[model samples]
Target: MSEEELNARHAEKMKKKKAARDKILATKTIEKGLLIVHTGKGKGKSTAAFGLVFRALGNGLKVGVVQFVKGKWETGERKILEHFPEQVTMTAMGDGFTWETQDRQRDIEAAKAAWERAKAMIMDEEHQMVLLDEMNIVLRYDYLDIADVIEFLKTKPADKHVIVTGRNAKDELIELADLVTEMEMVKHPFRAGVKAQKGIEF
Candidate 1:
């Protein structure tokens, strides 16, 4: 074919592709949000959870965040959430980190309290989104009651959306969710003996 004819054919293909994409986009549903669970041993579960919080905030949704096993240590997400006190309701369990907990019973109590707090926030019809940060781990560790948690979540208003983030989420929780995302660790800076960087992996 001549060069001009080839260019014309390319332009035609592009136009057809664009038109097809536009048609598909128009039919897409405005999602009613979801009951989402993020689980796996990957490093970014917490970050991914908060990323959704920021998205909800941008869309003018009220969000509730309850961190189950980590508090008293400064992290980028906490600082950002702190700035949006009105839009975001965050309650840290004050357990710091599981490994740092000197008393197991105390740790469990702290986590249980946070779980209860999260349940109440999620049950409230006014709360649009609930980010149960690391609550899955608490459930896995038996620090919180899975049955109670599930009941509370299931009873929430239909328009409410919940996001659970942690490593090792139970199969029951996964089954309960409308959407599930597993973040597998293919590679991580920590594996290379490098410390976690601020903002990116804090």
Candidate 2:
């Protein structure tokens, strides 16, 4: 086809696409807080959750974060979030990963403590968004009662958003969540013997 004909065809296709998208969007009028889950074995689960936290902060929304794991490590996100003391309430409650700690009981205790803090943030009216970092990992290990967690989350305020991030999310939690993202690992540097560098993994 001629260049002019090709350009005209593309413009016609795009016009139709925009009209269809606008029609579909018109049906989505209801606005409410969301229960979002980021799960799977991929590397960016927690990273994606932090991105949302940053977006919420940019919008002047108060955020509360409960780190269920990696509490011992000093992460770049944590350092930057700490600077926003007035808008962010963050608690790193985990001792470390279960394998590193090598104590099932200690891990359970730490998970419980973190869950308590998470519940408080979910219940608090001031916090518009709450991030439960590595929550699925604890849930996978059965460190906390899944039933109780689901029930508590069900009762969260209508206008409060909750984001949970970790691998192997439970079926029950996935069913209850309004949005669920499973990150599929296509390739990873860790598998190729590349150590996690600062500002990328942390």
For model 1, residues 62-116, the per-residue Cα lDDT tens digits are 9998878675444777777777778988788975757887788888888878877
Candidate 2 lDDT (Cα, 0 to 1): 0.90
Clashes of each: 0, 0
RMSD to the hidden true structure, all candidates: 2.6, 1.3
Quantify all predictions' global Cα lDDT against the true fold. 0.82, 0.90
Poorest stretch of ten by lDDT in candidate 2 = 70-79
Clashes of 2: 0
What TM value does model 1 have? Answer: 0.85
Tens-digit lDDT track for model 2 on 1-202?
Answer: 9999999999999999999999999999988999999998887888889999999998899999898887544478878787778999988765687778898888899889889989999998899999999899899899999999999999999989999999999999999999999999999988889987877766
- Candidate 2 at residue 14, lDDT? 100
Whole-model lDDT for model 1 versus the true structure?
Answer: 0.82
**The candidate that achieves the highest TM-score relative to the unseen native structure:** 2
